[model samples]
Target: MPAPSSTASAFLPVVPRLRSLRNSITLAANPIPVLDTYLNTYGDTIVVYLGGIRRTVLTRDPGLVQHMLQKNHRNYPKSDLSHGVARYLGHGLLTSEGSYWLRQRRLIQPGFHRQRIAGLVALMQTEINDCLEPLERQLAKQGGFVEVAVHALMITTAFRIIARSVFSNSLAERQLHRMAELLTAIQAFYVRTVRQPYLRPWQHARGQFRRHDQLAAELRDIVRGYIRQRKEASGPVPDDLLQMLLDARYEDNGEPMTEEQVLDEAAILLVAGHETSANALSWMWYLLAQHPEVVTKLRTEITQVLGDRPATFADLPGLGYSLQVIQETMRLYPPAWILDRVAQEDDTYNGLALPKGTLISGYLYGIHHSAKLWDEPEAFRPERFGPDQVRQQVPYAYIPFGGGPRLCIGNQFALTEMQLVLLEMLRRFDVEWVEQPAIDLMPLITLRPRQEIKVRFRRHKA
Candidate 1:
């Protein structure tokens, strides 16, 4: 279907002031409940007022999502709130907008090209095996279920792929840990600041912003050190992500990215790529733990595809069911749960007036779970993403990586990396949750599990 027409108004039924205040409070603490309550009560779209002054039009309409994200995308720049992220990540792809974003995107896009990323599959597999092998050996020694949190495992693996594969030896463990510290610190600050804007003065008074700036500077210096090393190295330069970034030039002036821009992009990828992929993969394992039948199906697919071998680049296509499982997991627990943009000018969409500076939150979580969009939308049904079913999917209905021009550049890399990691995990172990499901979301820079998910891994039997 085409994008939503401008003739249609945003948010079908506006939430009244009194109710909006109550809902707004709930949203600051836990948005999932608030979004669900209102989305069901107000149809696909709803107008919400935060603190009785800030109006956020939350919409799950696939058409409208596409309309703003793609059709008339220029009219809606990413919300100024990303400055919270910029405080840590600088003007990277995720936080940058306007001509700077465009220029930086062009410079960075080549690093994630399919061919380049394809070469990294071997690197990804090596890292996955490195992470899993020791765990498997320990599992064998234990001879039964051994509880281990998959979130940490996934996070570490993702970090290895990005840090080791791309930046290589330049990012030392100390610096990597520092990177994590900065990301966590900034995210906590950002989530708190955005959720409770009135608390900004409190945060500033508490030196939260100062600490964020300090950590951000440290992280930038770490990235810059790596970049400098690559440039100064006398040895033959490897054709990895860092090299690609160093080599990339602006299409117009043919100028290479400045060292500052390199640092920004590196910091962005280090955090965004690592966290999102890890979160998605961890959630997949969690879902599998809850759904043994789905795990069995995945096992069957993995067995049929790999036989006596490990999954490789060529094997990914045949691992269709495995990919479906990942796709379905993302649908249920999209890491980037919500997105917002500010209207650049006064406009009308289907007769709904969008005043300039209006913040529009494309409620991805709500849209993914909308009852009108799917049969049994709440159910964990991987078959829904099968070839035929995929054709029937409403555009913007499944945007784990977003869509249109602003679609995540590393989508291919993440998917392919996940394909290998998931297959390897399944083929090697029969996983079951040691603890209960990780259902509650800790909404921050990304949607994370409220509690870590513990899973017991035992060697798979013939």
Candidate 2:
């Protein structure tokens, strides 16, 4: 993909099974600190037993990560750790592989092009303003400042943006809430099963798997109903993601995707599109509240670009600082903090041997926060993304959206959404830090704050 950042050492370290077993509970509770401890004790790349059962090679080495994700991606497909979600989310882009994934990728990639995303700007802004109205009312009633649980607020805003972008007005408010609830429940349970494999037998005895499967079915049914409604409508199809999927034709054969295929991809789009942005936005507020200087700088940029107006897609490019803030937030707290891939066949990187079927956990969080890679890994600084500064950084060392051929399809959409949210919120309100205990990381299917993060929003005064 890019030049190897550094040479990977041939010597590999392994954490003993007994130690891993002993630390299983601690790892399940919060793996970031524990994993960091291991990497510190051992080296960048080490073999460890996940839950003390599954043998896995976990590494934060950027060179190896690029090798697996780009240089030889075909030789590394998503392992069962990732595909496990397919059992609940269906064989969408996030879960599917081989010719099917490639075909679907080619078919759907155009839908997220820069121009297509620009088309959805108005749709995104509409939803964002709607989401902000209630908070605005709250501020008016409370005399200018309102304390909010930023994570919950971000979740609602993000879901509405993605849901409306995809389905338009096809889904009612009640159904929208229900779909969000079901997806959350299924993902929570899925992460539990993966983290605590020892509890699976008991989980099975308790019908947890069956229950989540039912939730999955219910989620699909809700989307299916709306899809069928659109198919039966006589009028012209609305300009939304669902219609885009319906209208896409495969190149080899001019056939459109099947109903099931549409459902799977749409479901995938909903999940992938919303979750990452929501988490990143939540963490962005967390950082901004504490770093008011950064917020002040943001307000300056916002004022220079669009004084007395909300941002449109055309206005985003001028708001480079907003984008840098988002890029920095993701660097510190990446939503898809870690990614999994398995060696399709025997392979070598630098000098380490990876046999067929060997599981490799690309510790993206570790890579992002490594002191060797970043000047101040823990500090929040958006200036690192300035044009000149960015060019000098090592490649793959800052992959919040990942690297290589199979990079996140919604990367542009996500960046645009986050930038819009930051600019809009700061344009209207002054984000102030509220007194609370320090936030802890909750590494679920996505990285989340363990405790609620509260921030105060004061209406801006010129």
Candidate 3:
């Protein structure tokens, strides 16, 4: 990695630095804000030195992003940073590489096909209604405030949806809650390990790593138990992800997946399945709350399209404005805000040379907020996503779900789920923000709102 540029050195005083041993621990504890500060001051792209490792951040140029993610992907492979995460996730699609990743990707790609996802839209609607019914009753009677983090609620809902879609009875509240807790613990540990790699050796002795391992084991056991029960039963195969995976056979070998592979893939699906969607929903709600006109317009569109009925798969296409709202929200606060890759071999982009093993972090936040690419980049405007308007933007200027061969496979599923949930919630209730609360970016495995998003939902009169 190259040394910090003269510009970086010039801004050293403004950058937050760890002062003491205690402060260093705290800095390692949460460097998200510090990173955001650097991006804010350095204008999209900047090099930062963190714990002796130098990282080059590219945020302003979308063509650069496209080159790295799609055009020149072979040159850059998934970074070693993902290795620690794979310990818990297993060699699932998200973590696997080389032939393993290729095989998994090909096998699972069909499960997310448009036709397959369309079949699950009804299931998603059922789950959304199940979740919203109680909230609707609460809004009708007492007009209580929804103080929970929107991201957390969205994840909870998405998890149940994905769980039910995978294992018919996997939506049990207790099971979902347990899984959520375990996933949270695992992610927390992952954040700590990534920010401070030096502490990894002591993580096990300190009980933190042990706790994560235990949670991962417990999760695997839960999945294994589900698989075992499904196998024992002589009943009909359900039309869910689990069944799909069960039916899936390797094209070359015609061999069924091993039990361990099944469990690992299922776990990966559960984690990646909910986190990104939930974060998108949470950010969408936040954006909607900020822009009342947009909210009103969305409500009007939903009312006209659904006409007091729940949103169905067919209703989705007509919810174009709602889609735009979600798109704009993702633009402003993308959940998968950063993507990283380590050079597998020496590579060059434009004219700059990248050596082997150099870690490159793509800043989606900076790319979305870059004034050079976006007009009035800081403001929330859904019109920017209008069909013609979107055409005007650069190819990679607006990649919320990422791009390229390894582009998120669940993008279509997530978009449909978010659209359905947003329409359902907005149709039944009015979400009004309490106040513009302190906005802090907690960039972990995904970008998350630091504080709880408190809002009041008033049930719409019939």
Candidate 4:
């Protein structure tokens, strides 16, 4: 209930700490609805106490998000809310800040370039095909229809694609599964600690923190072993992300990243590369199952462009509707749903005052769903992203991959991978809705379905 550092905040509405405290339990369970309720009640921008512990400004204002993320980004580096992940994930691009982050970004940028990702298309498709083999087998045995837990399937499929993309054949299947498990365990626990800051002492007393730290160490060891294998390998270097990181040399001194640095970046890539795409692809299937009309339109575009042939890197650009579906899915269930930034200095947007050291939580989910920004904001309409429609919207209102100078480094890579997965899966199978309980959102580090999304996939009849 104490006043903020600056009077500029007075211009904004305040959700009392007590109210946020009362809602903290609900917020911890699923923050999207709790946050949406707050935004819906108190304009687009307001101040609320996070976890009833820290007073912070929460805004779904596209202008404010753009201002913090793009316009004057230097004054608004990622807050501890982001850095806190480094305890488990390491200080890679996602958790790092300032000049070091810039350097790493510059060094790793080329690896994700259009030309580079284009080259990886075959690798991605091969992995995608491999992932679908089991489903194909199930359909064959079950009279051409098989029920699948789509979220679990997408998680496995996405992790393989990213792992192969990063380590190529260096990691064995067992090792890959182990790494995935460790990452998931660490991330899930980290989210619990963050959402319930009051439980830190209890978690620590119960040795949960120590156990997760050990898990993180094991993850690092797995990655480090692979990096060392690449370093000690005797043959031609495999064309993979690990190689790309190995070959990258800083512009100034022309020195490659150290072993520890490589481990940090590689771990970050594995964590970042898989989770968002997995969640997006999972949500994409969920949405498509409910809306067969949308799926039919998608098939039309695919057949027109690809016929019975598989889509290659060149064929992807022509598949516009597929990308729009992915875009719209992200709009509905953005993986990186909310972002946190802390002000390093006093600043103001329009008439609102922002004192130095202000903590701002840019609610991207709200911005994407704001009635003021979109007509029928809750509807799933891929056409909204069509060329003309996209230009009609406000900037930063549709930032599924985030925006500004620090835009997701792997945005193009994620889009290409998601598009390829969608095309390949639809081309091979018919995704049908399977009756189940209504799916609820579980907004952890990423937005996921609270329960398994069950869907039936039948072999495509040409």
Q: Name the top TM-score candidate.
A: 4
TM-score of each candidate structure, all chains considered together: 0.94, 0.97, 0.91, 0.98
Error of 3 at 265 (Å): 1.0
- Model 2 spans > 4 angstroms off: 1-10
| Candidate models: Cα lDDT each | 0.81, 0.90, 0.77, 0.91
For model 3, what is the alpha-carbon lDDT of residue 67? 80
Give the per-residue lDDT digits (tens) of candidate 2, residues 394-424.
Answer: 8888887888878999999999988888888
Candidate 1 structure quality by residue, lDDT tens digits, 287-382: 888889998888778777788588878778888998899899899989888888888988777766777877889988888888888788889999
C-alpha displacement of 339 in model 3, angstroms? 0.9
Clashing pairs in 3: none
Off by over 4 Å in 3: 1-33, 36-44, 52-59, 143-149
Model 4 per-residue lDDT tens digits across residues 115-169:
9998788889989999999988777787868899999999999999999999998
Point out where model 1 deviates above 4 Å: 1-12, 23-25, 51-53, 435-438
Clashes of each: 5, 0, 0, 1
Off by over 4 Å in 4: 1-8
Tens-digit lDDT string for candidate 3 (1-462): 223344312322222223223244554645555555656665555555555343444445687678878999888778877766888878788888878888989998999998989988878888888877667666557665544457667877888887887787644578778988889889888887777767878986788877788889998888888888787878677778887887789999998889888888888888888777787788787877777899888878877888888877877888899899889989988888888887788776665556676677787887887788898998999999999998898889999988999999888888899888888887777777767656676677887777767666776664
Return the candidate ranking by lDDT, descending.
Answer: 4, 2, 1, 3
